[model samples]
Target: MQQYNPDFDYKSAAEEVLAIEIAGLKQLSQHFDTHFVQACQTILNTTGKVVVMGMGKSGHIGKKIAATLASTGTSSFFVHPGEAAHGDLGMIDSNDVVLAISNSGESGEILGLFPVLKRQQVTIISMTGNPSSNMGKLADLHLCIKVPKEACPIELAPTASTTATLVMGDALAMALMRARGFSAEDFALSHPGGALGRKLLLKISDIMHSGTQLPKVTADAPLTEALLEMSEKGLGMTAIVDADNAVIGIFTDGDLRRLLSKRVDIHDTTIGEVMGPNPQVAHSNMLAVDGLNQMQERSISALLIVDDGQLVGALNMHDMLRAGVM
Candidate 1:
């Protein structure tokens, strides 16, 4: 590697690169015409997945495009052009749409598979810098990803062209996402292990302490007993319930702090006398993210899950944090 140059004007060089890439993107935006709409409609109308194929740097971009399409409600996956020629072409179905990426629009490996693709009568959408190139000519649909220039000094490496291609891919993915009316819940279903998935898919019942794990005490219980239950359950709070186990009040660590300042007789005072009334509650089916929002808006750290006014479960900020729902 070249040694770091102290006087290289690195910041200016980086800014120039960004400016060129931005210009390429602007050029790309002008090409989003009927062809873009047709591409979206083709993918939406298909009963099979979008099989993306490319080579070299274009291949790398293809993988990302495929991933974005898959996560945004369009089922798609990337297939290496070289590999496809070697028997992976069997992955293609007649109902599938082939998205072929080649900056020059003349990748031999990609073009070599076209005859077979056409024989199978699969729809082909080609993304390229040259619409007149053979691969583009053979495609049923052509999307121009031509950029003004490459950021490379010699103009050999794919730079602005790849950026334009990736943005074009994003435009297609988002347009299809909106066209399908894909909701966050649907996106979360495909990304169940991600943070957004946890926020959208996890319910209050999924992480809340329930049954014997819940901290609760009878309304007539002494304040000291409520504290003992809170300590035992390790929830930092305890619910005060009536004879039917219906939640009437709640006492938390904050309440204990205030009670301590007032020199209240914990042994003699009943929990019902000092506990907070009209405690904010949620149903078991409430989303964990919504529960987090409730706690945040009310300036509280915990929430009680109740069903028909009966105390059922409890959760706090710690639980939300642990569940990755915070």
Candidate 2:
């Protein structure tokens, strides 16, 4: 078994790699000019989707770029260059834009599709390291992602070049997002199953315990009755309401513990006398993420749901957790 070296300069080696990649990224930024703007404008004005194609390492980067573009309000998809020659070219429409990635700008697989893309009248945007190469010369707009050197010691594997490509893709996606005025709600619509979606889309009404599930009692009710309501509902608290069912106050497990420590008589005391007045309340339509922020800010565990000053429902931290909004 290979033993771990306690004196190994792993941190130094990692820093060296990061330094090389950072320099490569700085170099890539200098190459962004009129062609980059033209590429963005082409995609922004495109009526159809953006088709991304590459081979090998470029293919992997192309897939991620496609995903980023699609998720950020751009309709995009990745089609393997090899597969495009095998009938997948039908996926491309004349109105769409093609983004072909090749580190050397001479990938035969990607180059082979240029004729068909041209024949279909689709705009070709090429991302390559060399602007003088065949694919770059053929492209309607060429965005160069040239890097000074590979981060790999042997200079064989793609490291700095891939990072620069990924960053350039992100820049394009963000530029498109800003131009489209893409909001968080629009992003949530596309990512309805992700945590960010839950945070933005989930409302208190969707998760709050309503109707008979609410732990509530009249303000004049005995403290023992309030405790019974809390225990029966299993919410660790009970809302103290007036005659019109408007929340007047709230009694919780913390209040019970404090009362017990002070030797207060729970059997004889009225809930109105011991309940906390003016409890924090939430609207039914309020976002669950906002509720979580309220709870954290106020250092509380539960909130009473109200509408037009009448108690309607209730929820706690556990509900937020179960809904994946935490």
RMSD of each candidate relative to the true structure: 2.0, 2.4
Q: How high is the CA lDDT of each candidate model? A: 0.93, 0.93
In Å, residue 52's CA in model 2 sits off its true spot by 0.5
Candidate 2 Cα deviation (angstroms), residue 277: 1.6
Task: Give the runs in model 1 whose Cα sits over 4 Å from its true position.
Answer: 1-6, 194-196
For 262-308, candidate 2 gives per-residue lDDT tens digits of 99988889999999999999999999999989999999999999999
- lDDT, candidate 2, residue 164? 94
lDDT of 1 by residue, 1-326 (tens): 87987888988888999999999998787789898999999999999999999899999999999999999999999999888888899999999999999999999999999999999999999999999999879999999999889998789999999999999999999999999999988988988887888998999999999989999998888888999999999989999888998988899999999989999888889998999998999999988999999999999999999998789999999999999986
Predicted model with the maximum TM-score: 2
Q: After superposition, how far is residue 57 of candidate 2 from its true place, in Å?
A: 0.3
Question: Where does model 2 exceed 4 Å of error?
Answer: 1-8, 194-196
